[model samples]
Target: MTTSNRCVCPDCDWVVDVPVTTTEVFKCPRCGHRLGGGAPVSERHTLALALAALILALVSLWLPFVGYSASGVSQTMSLLDTSAELLHFHERLLAILVLFTVWVVPVLYLLAICWIFTRLLGSGPVGPVTLYFIRTVVQLRVWMMADVFLLGALVSLIKISGLAAVELASGFYTFIAFVVLQLWVANNVSRYQLWHRLPHQQAPQSEAGRAAHNQGLSGCVCCQAPNSPQHKKCWRCGETLSLTRWRGWRLTLALLIAAALLLVPAHVLPVMETTSFGRTQPNTIIGGVLELWQGGDAPIAIIVFVASLVIPVAKILTLLVLLYVAERGNDSTVKNRVVLYKVTDWIGRWSMIDIFVVAVLVALVRSGQLMSVYPGNAALAFALTVILTMLAAMTFDTRRFFMPTTK
Candidate 1:
């Protein structure tokens, strides 16, 4: 329903007229405020586009992103081919990560989105099972990360502009489609609405259910508690907690620490050492940036340095500060704490700017021995560190950052 300079309350079906400037916020007249009363995503076209995206993604895997030729040898490379090349160069760890992030994970995420859209299309109120599916979709939204891969390709291209050449392939087009579909889905889907429609059941006063409830285990998103072992909602709050697939911050923290340690060596060591005839040169991230700067590419150098060096360090420090304050119960400055949380949350993924630059360089600079560019082990490790730490920060519950004022 189109509002004439007004916002409608989805809960009460009350249409409240608003001043033109207030169109940005959807405030209700009767109930005051509601978080998400946005448009529904039941459009037939979204589903069609989503399906098309999945097909394109599959085609991209088989087709090459671009073709390269050097020294009388020429070949086309798919996304998987790049990973294979990395593996061939004995960068086994990088190969595995690229395979997962670029080839496997995106595929799975798209497939899952397609399945969710299909289930939702046939629907009245989606059952508890579908509710779980919606949750999974939201969770996958955080980790899908195709844009980062695209960015890495872009970065790689700029690094070796003076050497070699690149030609676009069918796969690049498909990858672009994949990114568009993801953004579309994110805009249209309403997680709150999907879960809210499911029926609620109170938890039994029994000892087992009550104990589990107290321990934050019994209730989940879809079903009301006091119902059964399979009950979805809490007997108390009725707020949907993830019943089975709850994310663990502890494991995420460990992974981030391990990934960070690995990143130190990944950046310090040359990702790919180029050997032309008898001349050889190894390029670390710093070396690459310095070379770009000296060659009059100051803008690119600044961007790369900020993404590669400064952003990661800032993220690490921000997270450390948040964790420290939360642990110490420092409530003296609530506003500053909130500001830090917002900043940390927003900037966490900008680290992928370097990844984008890397991918572009790899695609553009494919001259084999004369000017070949390959993501060294450090690039892979550094990428993983960013991924892991971002995951850690997301799961770390910033609600804990704001110290409790009341005793």
Candidate 2:
């Protein structure tokens, strides 16, 4: 192997020897996680995109998102108004969650990116503040859900179109532009380049010590940088480190059990109850999918059924099996299992689409008796299920599966 650098795998803690002359991107030998890619992003371009994203976000939030009209009455919806409307209906928790994920988190994340880029691209010395900004940006990334909110709006538009006339507003188009810029910045931002540019500090562990530490090094879950085992937080991103390697089975197991329990009511109970022209009807997750299917929205129904129903139950089962396997000392197939873990982790976020739909419908359709929507108990239950499954995935330790069989 032609080699120039070596690093511990973030997922499995395998000591990987990277090839210097190879033309391909490096992936972890054990978990198949992408270690690094070709050519670092230029400081100038990354900074430009970050600044542009912030500007677009400001523009998007201020413009009216959409308009609804029926029975000689009309109303407008703005990006921030969704949370306000949700709050009016006494859905305090959903209101706060929407306010954070759709509005506050995205703005804070963009600001953090701009702050980091300003310092890293400037001639000024990057001290501990760089680490602070890096960590803040990482945490904010998970909470930012502007693009996801856009998808929810699309679903709501389709759902409400049959009952009322709908029109896209300036904010709707502006929000799409904001989402595009967000994606651009994410693709161009390079942690590898930024880490290299930060002021050099001595690794607490000597070269021999790092070698001896081997699989013991703590990897920053956010930036995936390997840090000394002695540190309480990541050196690169400052993310809190998980010190123990006992697999977090207790926490993970508890979350999975909670998620499984919630999943039952989530499917059985009504997710949305709508009243139109003095007639009331309730729709559960499966019932809504079938309703959509009967109404010639086979594609959309399939999407909702898979995202809200199939994915959650599948995630629960997959996590449970993996937990049992880990306890059984099956270290083989770590790579495939890690891949499964990634799928479960990423797909959990999309399950929020239904929750978003409920919020939108309740907000958009609330016009005294002629047409109105009230979220059923199942919406909260389903949302909680999504949250629990995501936590379970986060708490699970993939490294333990690859560790040598314990005596």
Candidate 3:
């Protein structure tokens, strides 16, 4: 294998040859991470989908997203209201988070895609600005949560359906379209193809079919380009490369510790308070799940339980285990450990579903005495816990799975 076809697996540190002309899906034999050998979607198609999604997003903003009527009182909520109402209650941080994840990030991602592909279509070279936009696109993909927010919105509606008249509006349908188109664009957009189109400086000569780390090389987290450990930045995308294999796990451990501490209050305190006919009841995370279960919405209850309780606890514990495995240099099950890290990283974001539900309910349910919902202290704590766990997983260097013993 030569420099042109050699690629390093980001998850397992395995070096493999990837042919440019192959159309079948490529997977790392060591850890099963997708290496992107499928037929690439055309830049024109991706650009068009992105533009369409942007239009739907803009339209969804001004239109009413959900409408609720109770005791002759009706309330209508637009998509932006979910975050705006949080601000009204002085949850500035939560409001900003919800706004960014649901609206701001997706819009920015779509705009970045449109800009990058437009430049590509013009046959222009990938300059610094285009490279910056490309990096932004990749980073913003995980934060785009319109689809998750949609599920939370539906759950919010279900929680109040028996008490009032609930109706989905034009904005809801438009957002559904936006989420679908956005996912289509995300799934088909190929980072491998994007970087291949750009120019890359020659890498130092290294043997093929061996771990890049063994040859003093590190894979760029941003562009997947192999870089010499001595180089501060990647030759392809200019992303900063990690110089040492043993770095980051200490920080990951610290974050996991903090998240574990916060998990206590996140479960013990109420996530939201409900008021009905001058009566107020505060519901903790598990309390809310139990309410849903006893109300005959067992499926939604199960969904909430897993997403809120099971996933977070499991993710924290799993990351701790991975850190221990990495430190112990247990290469016997490195492959399985890599897969576990990927699963935890992917599922960690879904834990925010409960947060989104709180935001939606706080914004959508408002009626004097008849019924109303207010966010609780646990809302922010739980949000922080989820975010910390996500950062912990990100800070964990997967390459350590293939590392020898660390002193």
Candidate 4:
């Protein structure tokens, strides 16, 4: 019930009091974004989970990942081979993307969480270093895609099982455990609790239960703490606060245009080339989907279609509509628009599933003469399309949904 429990919603800029002591889930009254409030997990417990996940991630890297046997020839792929093979074919950017999303980002995120929570469990004040790590955790959370990569791995295994004997290896189980623990740690580590534990300076006098911008305050994008307009850095987390509001929509528009332009090449060109019995076949995204469908793997084909085709195009179109709405100063469907933006941001990362599938196939199905999978031009183009659309969604400021468009 402390009066300092005031916060500005990052999504819609709604100001409300979210007591650190509350046990019920809190949502922004204006836009339905989760604002805080839940049964809090202990800092020590979160630290332990993070440490366990880190160990599993390391183990997964060292062990053999999967084994494939076909036509009396066999191959075993280590976890790193997914990216290493991509690099062997000169797909450096895609390789780096696969490596970071599946392994590096998750490990770094767990490390940051362990550091922050370990400090919180100690008897000392949370220092600047811990604060910085907390900021890192927030930013890295979205980019940690071990779970998506896991699904992609499963899909790759399914696609290849008919062609060969596929065996799950020790690293696969270890990675599954790591992904589960990492998700648990992510879910239980409450950002509100972390920010609450940090010491806060006296906030400038402003009424709670109103829009923060109306009172000459801006919400910290990193920590959601309301800051006075004059401050360039957040008082709580030291994140830079943007003074301008319109730049976000402009940047979002530019990125969307780039992504839209890339979609044509992504769909038209071959994503991966398959060679079997000395004959080569090239497949585009849609062509692959049709192949999977005709091959009786309709479920996976639908997944690939939705993730690779429908989602990206839908996201771009939806974002374009949102930009139009923001430009026209429409506020009637503001809540709906905010919800759409959230969904767009959340699902954008899943589009990379196809890219991961290609990486896995390229690495695992390397039997020369009998069969082989090679990275194609469309793989990079499609990857870039997904990335650009994701960036566009991130650049889009949801607060624009609530703000008035100026002439």
Candidate 4 local lDDT, 176-291, one digit each (tens): 99999999998888898778877766676667777888888878887788889888888888887873353487788999999999999999999999999889999898998888
What are the runs in model 2 whose C-alpha is more than 4 Å off? Answer: 1-6, 17-24, 199-201, 204-217, 222-230, 235-237, 242-247, 327-332, 405-407
Off by over 4 Å in 1: 1-35, 68-75, 124-129, 203-260, 327-336, 353-369
| Clash pairs (backbone) in predicted model 3 | none
Residue-wise C-alpha lDDT for candidate 3, range 117-216, written one tens digit per residue? 9999996678888888898898899888888898988888898898889999999999999999999988888887777676644866666567877777
* Per-residue alpha-carbon lDDT of candidate 1 for residues 36-71, written as tens digits (9 for 90 to 100): 456555647767877777787788777778665555
Best by the lDDT measure = 4
Best by TM-score: 4
Tell how far residue 342 is off in model 4, in angstroms: 1.4
- Higher-lDDT candidate of 2 and 3: 3
Off by over 4 Å in 4: 1-4, 243-247, 327-332, 404-407
Candidate 3 has what TM-score? 0.95
**Which window of ten consecutive residues has the lowest lDDT sum in model 1?**
2-11
The TM-score ranking, best first, is: 4, 3, 2, 1
What TM-score quantifies how close candidate 1 is to the native fold?
0.74
For model 1 the local lDDT of residue 178 reads 77
lDDT of each: 0.58, 0.74, 0.85, 0.86
Instruction: Report the Cα lDDT for residue 310, model 3.
Output: 97
The residue-by-residue lDDT of candidate 2 on 119-235, one tens digit each, is: 876787776777788767756666667777888889888877876799999988888988888877766665544554543354343232132235455555665556776777866
Best of the two (3, 4) by TM-score: 4
The 10 consecutive residues of candidate 4 with the worst lDDT sum are 398-407
